[model samples]
Target: MSTIENLLPEELLETLRDRAPGYDEENSFFHRDLADLKKLGYLQMLVPTEFGGRGFTLAQASQAQRRLAQAAPATALGINMHHVILGMAYTLWLRGDQRLNWVFEEAMAGEIFAFGISEAGNDAVLFDSVSTARRVTEGYRISGTKIFTSLSPVWTRLMVHAQVEGEDTLVFGFLEREAEGITIKDDWDTLGMRASQSCTTILDEVPLNTERVATHTPLGPNPDPVVWGIFGTFELLLASVYTGIGERAVSLACEIVAKRRSHVKQAPYAHDPDIRWQIASAGILMDGVILQLEKLTADVDALGTDRDPNYGAQWFLHFSGVKGRATEAAKEAVELAVRTTGGAQYFRSSELQRLYRDVLAGLYHPSDNESLHAAYAKALLGPAS
Candidate 1:
């Protein structure tokens, strides 16, 4: 690990985890807890050291998000934006964009940088931006709607993607917190990760100065910027959430199981061998997910701040696979808890049942498992295979 990555003490992380809000069965309440993360510098870990910031590598930042995910998936989702924005802008900065210096400085001064991708009814909004940036005499005019925009409510600055000059080329732009006509719809009700406050955002004629935009052309369609690889940071972040979810599931399941009277109660699940098998199977899944994340993250960190020049299909495939594997494990482990708990799991007061519902919703964050499935299959059938 880099000296910088090692600087964040374990005790501090534990304290942050301890202070994180409990997983509320009601989604919106989880979202209200987002304010706590903003009070900390967790949102700006990516600013360069020259800017008086941590400038953590993708691996280090992913580890932090994943560690936190071990506690609150919802809270992790709320903050993953900072890591993504940092990694993205850090790459641009590496390519000699001095314009990003102020943004880095702002981050060092404790600004939350959010990525306005993932619109409502759309999954891969990063690749396809419905938001368009039209050139004006002064700068540009941006207008459109984005869904699941995390951490923007408390953000002082933002990193947004839109079509520049009404051209096919996609561009990244910065938006101020007090920008005119920037509205947020917090009606995001879902099964999990409710603390994200990932509401829909509407930009109606928001002015963006020329000095505030990045990515004059698409950095995708191959490997120059490794946009998909850049997206790997998010996948890893979600993987951390899964690891945390599994850890919490086991802890909660064991506590409840210990309370059940094995001999007195005529319980079907209490002593069934099948239940034992299910428990063992869930353990295997959790172990596999953790192993994969640890290995991948170690490799990412070893790569340091230099973004890879070539995009390996296998690495990309691994990234796509982890989210599906981890998400499925988290949901399955929680569902197993619900089943083992029996009919009582249905009661309004059942924590196992609440965990099941609340856990599954986070599966939808960033790249949905279903979309990654299709994308993975297409890659295999390509001529390169």
Candidate 2:
């Protein structure tokens, strides 16, 4: 099995890294990177082998994602939307559910999927949604606005969810990006991760034919495989990207320190005990983050969905903790890198500065620091009396 180091061509990563600054500077999408990834068959990496795809396991894909983030965090994050969709489908398929097999078949045929689950003030996560899926003559008419719709510029299909009006059902469906009444607002300007183009998507009575509806389950907690699949794949992959960013930051710090000479000591900064210590600390933290992510991913791929009934909740707790820790590690590593590199790294052009800004975004994803801690506490200590 090819390791993450060799999963993607080195030259491609170099090219993407070289172009990342320009894309960020102009707040443009990484169209070139996306096109290259498509040409390389990365878009269909999760499809089953029978469907002529690489059929990569979740562990393999997560490793590749971490590697990809080392070069370009925004690009890795944007492409993650597609991977999460395919990963979810693959997870379900492994559990003997063929309902989502068509997603793989479509992916192999060159369809790109985008995630459209986030909404304004929807803190219930997957259990509830503000969007309404009104019953229609043919299927359902979905009307809601979704935020953080990553890969908005190029996704061919949007996987979304909405509550059925006057019912206890939450419908999951895939709508074509070009379908009528679907408007994509190009308003994704942010503090970092600019190239992702995760714009706001407004669905105004978007129609979903009977054939397009994927799944319908009662709202709130349930024993649905799709829910577990989404939670497992999304959290792990998100953590992987931030972990990659952390890895890159530490390497850059080491490179910067190795070339500088301390005139007073008449020696390279690399020989300075303080600089060495800082780098060592960052490396140790990053290593822990990477190992945790790898082990969890391996477990998921190995166990599939046939484990104990409590596996889902326990797995989520683990994932939430890892995601929070990985993001924090990446942020700390980037901060240390800036300190090691001196004042010059504060410039807008500095890669470390970009990483610093990018790492802050981790605090905003699902299972935020507070939520993760709450969940962990609830899991271990039980809910407050």
Candidate 3:
């Protein structure tokens, strides 16, 4: 019954916006923001109503993330990892796999989950992993270094995947924070999204209990539910954050141009044709991104409910396209705002400066521009000969 507005009211957003600069300047985690959001039960917003959560669909959650990002992109991005995990579990559940039901239950109990899927040099992503998963008497002992492990400060559980030793299998499992053999490095310095504290995690023979193991699939592209769930939820939510950044940039541009006076013209810069063109162009780019995101998220919700047998065959094309487009749009829109806003935005004190840095981080996320184009090309030309 909780609406997105109720969960993230304007007052909270204003507070987050006020604190954003300090957090970025200090390069510290968004502990206060996380605490406030926790109090609102925002962390468990995706759990179904039967499980004592708001029972929000992915579409609704994506919209909420966009609003949150508009206030503080770093906080929204840091929390997005947890939501991505929840979304994946819900996606799989809707598809009739109950293996991740415990995820929702644990979320209800206030257990925060972090994503540990990225490896230092592993470009294959979900289809392959550089980490090794060795068979043990009880279950599996995974040993490798995971990079970009967001929510490193407060996660109670981490979802990780690794390639099985001497086999063509990739295993997915959850590792507890209290479990031995997990080391979190203190190095998380970055150009943007600093509040995320996405530190590098070293896993030295960490034990995954039998019940903790979630999925086992052959290496490389496959029709596994785990892969589908992660890709769908992650790409959509990540795109939503960048889209929010674009929204913020465009909004600020409008405010600045309307108030900023052009001495020569003796009027607000909004009357200038060039400035109007830049702002309008930004709006045009954002419009396409919003439409793409809405359509894709709605399709995901429908697919989850109806069990479409062929719904996901070419999903990579759409998912990667949205993320690529959104990131590019955010960056371009932020640049437009910066150029039109004049010299003030170049200073570190300017909020637009922080946005520029944060928007840059989107370029490094998975499904980068190259991958996006590749997906589209593959869809048209087939795999490389």
Give the Cα lDDT of each candidate.
0.66, 0.87, 0.92
**Which has the better TM-score: candidate 2, or candidate 3?**
3
RMSD to the true structure for each prediction, in A, is 4.2, 1.8, 1.2
What lDDT would candidate 1 get against the real structure? 0.66
Per-residue alpha-carbon lDDT of candidate 1 for residues 1-385, written as tens digits (9 for 90 to 100): 2343254346645554454444444454343335444444566676777776666766667666666665666677677776776666665576565656676777766677776766666455566677888889878888889777776456666677777764677776788879898998777776656666677789998888888865565734434343643566667776776667776676666666656655655663446676667766667888888888877766655443454433365666777688778888888888777666567768857655655766776566656777777777777675334
TM-score of each: 0.81, 0.96, 0.98
Clashing pairs in 3: none
Cα error, residue 279 of model 2, in Å, equals 1.5
Q: What is the alpha-carbon RMSD of candidate 2 to the true structure?
A: 1.8
Tens-digit lDDT string for candidate 2 (44-156):
87888888888788888988998899999999999999999999898888777888899998998899999999899987677789999999898999999999999999999
Pairwise TM-score winner, candidates 1 and 3: 3
Clashing residue pairs in candidate 1, if any?
A: 30-195, 31-195, 70-244, 192-361
Order by TM-score, highest first: 3, 2, 1
Clashing pairs in 2: none
Give one digit per residue, the lDDT tens place, for model 3 in 280-338.
99999999999999988888887645545355577877788889999999999999999
Judging by TM-score against the true structure, name the best candidate.
Answer: 3
Model 3 misplaced regions, further than 4 Å? 304-310
